[model samples]
Target: MSPILLTVNAGKSAAVARTDAPSGLTGIDKRPVDGEVAVSAPGPRGVGGSGLAGDSIADLRHHGGDDQAVYTYAREDLDHWAAELGHPLENGVFGENLTTEGIDVNDTRVGERWRVGDELLLEATSPRIPCATFADWIGERRWVKRFAEAARPGAYFRVLRPGTIRAGDRIEVVHRPTHEVSVAFAFRAQLGERSLRPRVLAAGPALHSELYRNATAWAENA
Candidate 1:
């Protein structure tokens, strides 16, 4: 099936936080918005295109930046979760800026580039790391471990060209790096899975700097 955007979501303020969660602050509480949302590159240490014009990033240290400018989750994956959890899963519930359909997000290579709409260009950078905020947001026990075991952690993208994107926008894979390091591979490597760590090298400089360094170190030790 052709990849199409199912929803465009953004958070105007700090995502709803829970005192019970490990991290009290989070920006995962995104909601779908109507019409077109502007997509643009962010300034240094700034929020990127997916963040929307008035969106907020509560924790700058770990989330929001050029490398993780846009977050995408697959509708197919959400469907799986919905069946497992016995509830309807809505777009943006996973904290993704784009809810996409017909895309194998986990299988996408680390350096894949996507053309959304007519002008926006985005590059896949890394897989999202399940955080305490995510666990609480989903209200699942052992959520992080479960999410990792599922190996369906979606991808984060870096904005290449700025434009506007919305629900129903066409998504095309414009490029795919030769590297065998898919988002799932990178996610496993980030979890200290030595066997998969070497795949990170295939991603070359396309990997996030910190992740690239950590993966390189692990591969060297291996």
Candidate 2:
């Protein structure tokens, strides 16, 4: 199967659930949309949220920004989790803006650039760091620990070119940086694998600002 977008998901509204979240609400209940959805950079974190026009992100401090304008997860990963958990998982259930097929999202290089549809250009920036809200939303025991241990946190992208995206859009990798820092490796580093910090820092400017800063500070102190 060729790499393509399986679904475009956006939160319908913020729900007053997820006590683990700072806002006492969660926008993780994203649902598949029928038609085209506009995509663009949503500025900086804490102020901007979700690149998809109608999407809502309740936790602004941790999610959404120019670096995390879009979040993507693979249907394959979802399938793996579904079988492991003895239940079926729906698209967008993980709060990903895009659910992809036939792509190794976790293995993607941190600086890779993907062209979605015709004009939506997205640059891979970082991996989703499972949070308390995500754990609460999943409603599984030790979900955060399990997710982090699995080390397949999926990929987050920064929108470089704004355009409309819908289900079935083709995804083409137009560019990949020379660094070996991949989404999985970055996630491992984020999870306290100090040995991988230097390699993650090698991604340099292509890395998300926060990750880069953390890596830089670690390297300096080490």
Candidate 3:
């Protein structure tokens, strides 16, 4: 089935937080919303204007900005988690701006671009690296380790074209780079397997700028 946006989500404030949140503040508790939302390039913190129009990033040091402008998660993966956790996994619960259906988000390669609705163009940049904030948000024991081990971390994107995005908007793959650095591969390489670091180089400069910098730094030090 063709991938479609299952939900459009955003947050107006950083109210979604735990008293003991690792980062001290977190915007990971996004909720779904109705109507159309604008999608655009990085704004103050590299956040897109789409469904993430007012989304806030608590830990600017690590999350949000250009390469991490928008996050997309798959309903299929959410379903898996729902089954595993024995509870319902709602859209945007993971702080993603786009909850997509029928997309192999984990398998999508870095640099692949998707056109949403008429004007939004987003390019996959990197896989989310679970953090203490995420673990605390889910209230699951060892959630970070479990999520990393699963290797199904969803993808982050950089907005290429600005436009409105709403639920049921169609997604079309407009560009797919000739690289093997899928989101899952990149996630495993960075978090689980150091040997795969070299593989990330195959993605070239199209790899997320931050990830590219990290890989370059690793290479320089190695």
Supply every candidate's count of residue pairs whose N, Cα or C atoms clash at under 3 angstroms: 0, 0, 4
Question: Against the true structure, candidate 2 has what lDDT?
Answer: 0.91
With a 3 Å backbone cut-off (N, CA, C), the pairs that clash in candidate 3 are 38-49, 38-50, 39-50, 46-66
Candidate 2 lDDT at 149 equals: 93
Q: In angstroms, how far off is 210's CA in candidate 1?
A: 1.3
TM-score of each: 0.92, 0.97, 0.91
The global C-alpha lDDT for each of the candidates, from Candidate 1 onward, is: 0.83, 0.91, 0.83
Model 3 lDDT on a 0 to 1 scale: 0.83
Per-residue lDDT of candidate 3, residues 46-72 (tens digit): 333322677766666677777888899
Q: In terms of TM-score, how similar is model 1 to the real structure?
A: 0.92
| RMSD (Å) per prediction | 2.3, 1.1, 2.4
Point to the candidate with the largest TM-score: 2
- Model 3 collision count: 4
lDDT (Cα, tens digit) per residue for candidate 1, span 1-222? 799999988884453556232345566778898998898766544333334555556666677788888889999999999999899998889988999999999999988999999989998989999987788889988999999999999998888888888899999999998778999999988886778876688798788777888878877887
Per-residue lDDT of model 2, residues 154-188, tens digit only? 99999989999899999999998887899999999
